[model samples]
Target: MKTIIYCWLFLFIISFNLYSIKISVGEADISLRLTDTDFTIDNYNFDPPIKETYSVEWEAIDNMTYIKFNYTGQAMGEKIARGEKRYLVLFSK
Candidate 1:
């Protein structure tokens, strides 16, 4: 019946949304170190570090927007050279 189909579709949509919990992350200033030549490198293997997994959060205090992400990833893949910087990002499902 129509009622059963509607219920099933609604449940399906809800479950799908729950699985992802998409969040958008953006900021003006983010920095990361440089590669090679630098004493600090990912795992010290001379390879690019893997992108880290992060939990996203946001806050607003008197017109200042603050976004924070907790990294659950290894620092092995994220290394820049001296006096350099890079933006780190990740989307979770």
Candidate 2:
């Protein structure tokens, strides 16, 4: 029973790690992370900086995957020099 429990725990950890993605630019103070169902971005280049996380919706089409999410943070609008934006991200195996 103990062995079975340990095995399951190990598998869970491995599965979680397999589906997680992280990207960082050297000395840019910008990073992005995507998990199984969530997406996050951290950018410290703005006047007030920006760090927000939004739920991700994904769809599989042909050999590619599409990820969509909305950002309603301080970095939005014309005053900040960035207007309403839409991003199309594609992920392929």
Candidate 3:
């Protein structure tokens, strides 16, 4: 009985690790964690500096539209000068 319970627990842990995501940049860090205890986000931001700029985007992806919103602790605006750093962490509806 003990062996059966242990085996089931191990399998459950493996399944939880598959649907998790973590995003960050070199100096900037961001975390979007959902605390349902059903899904896990385990450092899926395997890369740094994930810049998804819509500088000249003609339309949205999958027929989606993004309206105005704000992201605290993040730089969310167009460039005024030369290179520095920008980070946006919100895509609201």
| C-alpha lDDT of residue 9 in model 3 | 9
Q: What is the lDDT of residue 6 in candidate 1?
A: 9
- Runs of candidate 2 with Cα error greater than 4 angstroms are 1-18, 23-35, 75-93
* lDDT tens per residue, model 1, 5-61: 000111112333432222222211222211112121122232444333443344456
**Candidate 1 residue spans exceeding 4 A from truth:** 1-51, 74-93
Better of 1 and 2 by TM-score: 2
Q: Give the per-residue Cα lDDT of candidate 3 at 79.
A: 24
What number of clashing residue pairs does each candidate have, in the order they appear? Answer: 12, 0, 1
Q: Encode model 3's per-residue lDDT on 1-93: one tens digit a residue.
A: 000000010111225564222433233333322332221112223332122221211123465532211221212343222222223323422
Question: Candidates' TM-scores?
Answer: 0.26, 0.37, 0.19
Model 3 bad stretches (over 4 Å): 1-18, 25-70, 74-93
Model 2 lDDT, full chain set: 0.38
- Largest lDDT belongs to which candidate? 2
Clashes of 2: 0
